[model samples]
Target: MPWKHADMVRWLHPQHLIRSGMDALVASIFGVRADHRLIVAVGRPQPPYFDYSDEAAGEDFWLDYVADTGDGWNSTYAVARLLAKPSLELKDPNGDTHALERGRILVFGGDQVYPGASRDTYEERLAQPYREAMSRSPDPSPHLFAIPGNHDWYDGLAAFMRLFCADRWFAGRRTRQSRSYFALKLPRGWWLVGTDVQLNSDIDVPQLEYFRQTATYMQPGDRIILCNAEPAWIHAATTPHPRGYMENNLEYLQEKVFGRRISLFLAGDLHHYKRHEDAEGRQKITAGGGGAFMHPTHAPRALRLRDGCEQKKCFPDEKTSRELTRQNLMLIRHSPFFGLLTGALYLILALSAYTELGSHGLLNIHEALRQLAASLVNRPMSLVVGAATLGGLVGFADPAFGRWRVPMGLVHGLAHIACAFLVAWGAMYFTVSTLGICAEPPSPKLAAFIIPGANACAGGWTHMWAKFLLGTFLTFAGGFLVGPFVMGLYLTVSLNNFGAHSNEAFISLAIPDWKNFLRLRIDPEGQLTVYPVGLERVPRKWKATHADRYSPAYDPDDPQATDPILIEPPVRVMPREQAP
Candidate 1:
C-alpha cells in the first residue's frame, strides 16, 4: 500500500496524544512531592543529544538541522578537552586558592541526540564522538549519568534504555543507571538528583518510589543539585502563561523530597544559557546550550498577559535583553537554511496549484477572490472575526498590557487565526497569479502529467473540479494552519526541539555553532561552582563570516586552533541556607 500524507498524520496523532496523556498522568501521580530518607546514589553518566546518525546514513532529508560530528570546536572535542583537564583553579572570598574538582560524575540534563531516540543514531552521534574524545584525552573518565528529556521518550524510551539502563558503553563511558531517575551522593554532603520530566512533569511509579526510598537516607542540612530536562520554572516565570505547572513540579520536588534542601536546580531542553533567582533566593539555572540549535536569550513578549509572564520578576529588561537579541540577529543574518525552507514551501505550493489549475482552466482567479470575499460576508466569518477580536481584548485587559504588551491565550489564538486567514488569502493569490493566468486545457499526455492517476479516472468537468477543490482545500488548510504565527512562536517560544528536523515552516531561525556544556564542580569546602564552556571562542566575524553557514566539526588535528574557553568567570553559588 502506498503511504498517504493523511495516513501518516493519523498514525502520528495518537502517538503524540499518548505522550501527552502520559504527561498528564505523571503530573497527577507525582503532583505533590513526598518525603523520604536519602537513598543510595546511583552512578550513571550518559552523553547529550540521543540521536545524530543523519550523515552516517544517506543524506537525511531533515536530521541535518540537529546532527553534530563533534569534529568542530562545539561537539565532543571541546567538551573532551575540558574533561582532559578535569579541574579548575579558583580563589575564595578571602583570596585564598580554592581548588574545584570538575565533577567525577558527568550529569547530562537530557537530549542526547536529535530526530528521536535510536541506538544507532546514539552510537554514531554520541558514543563514538565521546569515545574519540576520551581516547585523545589523558584524564580518567568520569561516571556518566543522564535524565531522560522529551526526545528520549519520543521513541518510547527504547533507545534510552538500551544506551543508559542496559549498561551500554559509549567509548569508555558506561551507563550505570538502573532507571531513568537517580540520586547521587556526592562529596561534602552534596547530592545530585536528576529527574525525568518527559511529559507534564511526570515521574513513573517505579522512579517515584525509587526517589522515595532514596530519600530515607538524607541527613539534615544535606544540599541537593536538582537536574531536570525542561526548564519549567523559567517557563513558569513567564507571565499570563498557564501560571505554574513547572513551578508546581519543582515545588513538589523541593517540599516533599529534599524539604527545601535543594541548593540549585538545573534544567536543559532550551538550547541556551540563563540564570534566575527568586524572591526566596532559590537559584534556577538553564544551561541547555549543549550542542543543539542555540536558543535566543531575548525575553519574549508575554503572549498572554500584560507585564508578560515574568514570575519572580526575573525577565531581563531592555538593556540586558539586547545581548540575546544580538545573538538572534546574528543567527538570522548568517543562516541560509531558513531562506531555503521558505522558498521551498512557496515552490511546493505553486506546483500543487499547477495540478489543479492546469487541466481545467475553469476557475478564474478574480472570480475566486470575489467568491471568497462574498463568502466571508456570512455569519461564520463574522463570528470568527468577533471571537478573535474578543480574545485580543481580554488578553490585553491586564493593566500592565499598556506598558509591557504581554500576550495571553486569546492573543496567541487570535494571532494563529489571523495568520491562517492571511495565509489562505495569499496562497489563493499566488496560486491564481502564477497558475490561473497561464492555465490552459491540457493535452492527453499533459492531463496524465497533471494528475498521476488520470487514466484510471472516469469523470467529466464536474469530476475534475471535485478533485481540484478537494486537493486545493486540503493544501490551503495545511498551509494556513502552520502559517506565520506558528513559525513566529518557534522563534519566540523556543519550543519543539528548537525547530529541529525542519518541523518549523520557515528557515529564518538559524542554529549556532557555539556548542556548550556545563561543569558542575564541588570544592573541598563544599562550595558548588558551575563553569559553562563552549567548544571555541565565538569568532569575532561570526556575524559576517558565518552569515551563510557554520561548520559543525573542526579539524581534530588542529584542536588547539579553537580550544574551549570559559565564556564567563566561574559562578560560585551560595549554599541553600545562605542563599537568602
Candidate 2:
C-alpha cells in the first residue's frame, strides 16, 4: 500500500496514541506541572530491616518462600543495607532553611530508594519516608518535581508510579495530563525541566526538544535550569573518554547548546559532592550525597579545576575554594574491637603452631631432622606455609590490623620467586641423581664431562643427582629462609588492611554526602541561595546592623524579636554560569 503525505504525517506525528495514553495515565498518576520555579531535593530513601525467618508465619507457604528459604531475606537485605541510614541532614551548621520555602518548585535528583521499585518495596522504602516528611510539614507542602533513578525503575517502575503519581490530576485542568518529561514555567522567567534517563529511553531527543522550546520561551538574560538525576557535567569531568549515548548527549549540550544563556545542571547518584566548570563556561554540580552512603572524599584534579594546585604536588588544595566537598554527620569507625579480635586470632594460631612443633623438640632438632621430616611427612611444612599464606592474605584484606603496613604486591612477588626457585632446584636434582647412572667419558669437544647413557646406571645417577640438589636446597630454604619471609609478609598485609579499613570507615562517617538536605537561604538582594543543606558556610563578616537583625542575645521564647536573620544589600554574587 502506498502511503500519502497526510498518512506519513500522521505516522510521524510527535504524539502516539498508546504513548499518549500512557502519558495521560502517568499525568493522572502524578499531577504534572509546567508553571513554577522548581526546587529539587535528591536523596536515597532508607528501608527497614526485617528478620523473615523469625516471623510468626514461618510455616505459611508465601512467608516460607519469601523469608524462610533465605531468598527473600537476601534480596531485602541487599536493599535494606543501602537504606540503613535515612537522615541526610543537609542543613548547614549555622542553621538556614528559608531557601527551601522560597523556591517555587522542588525536584528529587535520584536514588529515591536504594533498590528500584517493586510493590512492597516502594511501600517499605519510599512511601513511609515521604509520609513522615509530609507529616512534619505545617501545611500540605510545596509542589515536588522528581525524576526516576536507576533504583526507582528496578522492577520496571510499576510500583513507583502507583505510589508517587497514581492519583494526582493536573493543576486546574482535570483532563490535560502530565508526562515524565514535562517542564514547569516559573513566574521568575525560569523554566525547570525534569527528565527520565532510565534504561530504555534516549535523553537526546527530549533534551533537544526542551532546548528548542526553552529558546522559544526564554529571552535574553533569563535563567534556564535543567535537572537530571545524573550529573552530566561531573560525568564528563571524571570520564575522560565517555563512550555511550549519555556521554555524547552531555558533550553536545556542553559544546553546542548551553553556552548562550544562564543554565545550571544539577544531578545526584555519586554519593559525594562535586562541581565543575568546563572550558567553554558551564557549571556542573553533583550533589549526590543525599544520605544513602558517603563516597570517598575527592579533591578536584588540576585539570578539572582552573585554579587548583597540581594534584600530585598538593596534598590538599584550598579547602574553601573546592567546588566539590564532602559533608556527613556520624563518623563511624571499624571498632577497635575487630582489630583486637583479629590480633587474638593470629596469636592463637601462632601459639598452636608453637605448641605442636616445639613440644616435639622440632625447633631444637638438627637441620637434618627438618630435612628428613620435609621428605617424610610434608604435612607440617605444608601447614606452616598454608597458615602463613592465609595470615598474610588476611592482613592484606584489611588495613586496620596494626603497625604493619605491608604491600600485598611485594608479598605475592616474593612468594612466587621462592616457589619458582625451589621448583627449579627440585626438578634439576631429581632428574639428575634419583636413579643411579654412569655417564660416558667426555669427548674431545668437552674435557672430562660425563654424558647420560640409555642404560639403567645413567638414569639412576641422573635421578639421584636431581633429588639431592633439589631436596637439599628446598630443605634449607623452606625451613629457615621462607618462614621469616612469610611472617613478615603476613604482618605487612594485616597491618595495611587494618589501617586502610579504619581510615575508610572514619572518612565515610565524617564526611557525608550533602545532597540530602534542603539548603535554603535568602540573600540581602532577595536572591535565594538554594544548595545542598550541609555545605560549610563560606566565611563572611556579618553586617553590624542590618534591617532584618534582632538582638543576638534574644531568648528563644521571646516572640517579639524572633524575625528571621537576613543579610543586607550587595548580595554575594553566586556565579550563575560556571566554566565548562
Candidate 3:
C-alpha cells in the first residue's frame, strides 16, 4: 500500500521545507532567545524551578521521558496511548516482569513538533493526538514539563511558550515551567533539570543563569538528572569538530554548578534510544523516540561513545537498523512529490538535448552515447542542469561528513546526471516509437528536429499538439518512475556505507516502527531505574472500542498489534552519597 499522508510527516514536502527554512532564518536574525529573558522577568510562574520534594508518593514515584515527538498520527498516538497507561508491565528475556506505574511527572525532552513549530502545527501534531490518548488515561493529571528542541526553536519558542509555559492543562497533563527550560526538584534529593540549547548551539546566558540559580538550591549530596536537546557528548566524540564549548558548557553546569552530581544525562533529537555508561555508572542516554521517523542507529557515528562510556544498549540494535536501511529502495512509496521534482529535472535535460536524442534513438546506443557526451559539452542548458545537480547534492550533505562530503556528493550527483540522460533517451524512444507522436523520424542531427513543415503539414494543430503533449507526458512519466530510484539508492548507500545522509534516508522512510519511550522510577533509596520500552510496529488499523468506551479513543483492531518490547534491561542510577 502507498503511504497514508495522515500517518507521517513528509519532511520533503515543499510547504514544510519552505516554512522550516523561513522560520530558521527569521529566528537567527531576530535572536528569539530573548524570549527566555521576558519569561523570567515577567515571573508569571514566579520561579525557575518547581520543587516536587514533597509528593504524595514521597521518595517513590514514576517519571516518564519522551522526545522528538509530533510527526505522524499513528506513531505519536501509539506512544502517547502507551504512556497514558495506568501501569505498563513487560518482561525481560529472563521473564522477570517489571510493572511500571504511571508517571506523576511527564517530561518532553524536546522537538515537540515536526519540521517547524507553529500554533496550528503544535495543536494538531502535538496536542490533538496526545490529548486524544489522554482522554482515557485514569488520572490525577500528570505534571507536564518540556524543553524546546531545534524544531521548536525554529519559531523562537512562541508556540512552545504558549503550550508548555502557560501553566495550562494539556492532554490530561498539567503544564508547568515558566520557560523553554525547567527544573523539577523531586523527592529524596533527586533533581530533573531540562535545558534549552537552541539549534544545538550554546545555551543562552539567561538559561545558563537560570540553571546556575536553580543549582544554588541543591544540597551537596543531591543527584541531578540533566536533560538537554542534543547529545553534545556524541558531538564531542566525533572528530573534525569544534574544540569544545557546547559540551564543555554542559560539563561546566554538571561539574561546577551542579558539583558533578549529575548521575544521568538524558536527551532527544536523534529520534532513537541509545545509552552510554561510564565506569562510575554515570549514564548519557538518548531517548528521542517519542514519535517522528526513525533515525538510523546503524550509522558509524551513532555508535561512537565518548569519555570511556561504552555503548550499553540501543533500540532496534545495529543489525536490525542496517537491515531497515534497505527500505530506502522504495523511496517513492512514501514521498511521491519528490518524483515530480526529479521528473521536471529529467524533462529539462531531455528537452535541452532534443536535437541529439532525435538524431540517434536509444536503439542506436553507440551513437546516442557519443551524442550525449557532446550535448553535455555543447548544450548550455544541459551543463546548467549538471552543475545544479552537483551543487544541490553538496548542500544536502551533512556538515558532519567533513571533507568526505565533496567526493561523496560528486559521486551521488553524477549518478543522477547519468540516470537523467538514460531516462531522457528512454522517454524520447517511447514518444517516437511507442506513441508514434513524431512523424518522419528517419534523419540525422538537424533533419530529425527540422520537421516543423512536416509536423504542421501532416495534420494541423491536433496532430502537432498530440506529439507535443504526448512527448512531454512520456518524458515526465519516465522520470517519475526512475528518478526516485536513483536518489533512494544514493541515500541508502551514503547512509549505510558512507555515514552520510542519515537524516535524508530515514525521514524518507517515515518508519513508524521501533517507537519507544522511557519509564523511570525513583525508589525510597533515591535509586532511579530506567526502563526503555519499544514497539516494533505501530497499528494502521484502529477503531473506537465499545467495550468500556472509556478506554483510549482509538484501539488497534489487530489482536497482534505490535507488542511493546523491552529494548534493554532496566538501568539503575544510584544516588550520590551525602557528605559525612
Highest TM-score scorer: 3
User: Per-prediction TM-score, please?
Assistant: 0.57, 0.44, 0.91
What's the CA RMSD for each of the models? 12.7, 21.0, 3.6
For model 3, name the residue pairs that clash: none
lDDT of 3 at 179: 74
Tens digits of per-residue lDDT, candidate 2, 333-362, equal 212122232333333332222211111222
Winner of 1 and 3 under TM-score: 3
For residues 1-580, write the lDDT of model 1, one tens digit per residue.
4211110111123353465456545434533333111121234333212221122132111100111222222343445434434454544334454444545456777877653456765665566545544532224444567777766665556677677777655545555775677777765666678887655565545456666766776677667778888766655545345445634544566677667677677887765566655444455666665555444444432222221222222222234433443333333243323333333343343332232222322256555445445544533534555464546545533332333334444554555444444444454344443445224443353344244322212344544565455445644554533543343453334322222212221113334345556666554556667665544332212111121111212233432345454545555566645732
Ranking of predictions according to lDDT: 3, 1, 2
Candidate ranking (TM-score, best to worst): 3, 1, 2
Judged by lDDT, which candidate is best? Answer: 3
Better of 1 and 3 by lDDT: 3
Off by over 4 Å in 3: 1-5, 32-45, 56-59, 136-140, 244-248, 300-304, 356-363, 373-378, 439-465, 546-551, 575-580
Candidate 3 lDDT tens digits, 160-183: 888988878888878867777788
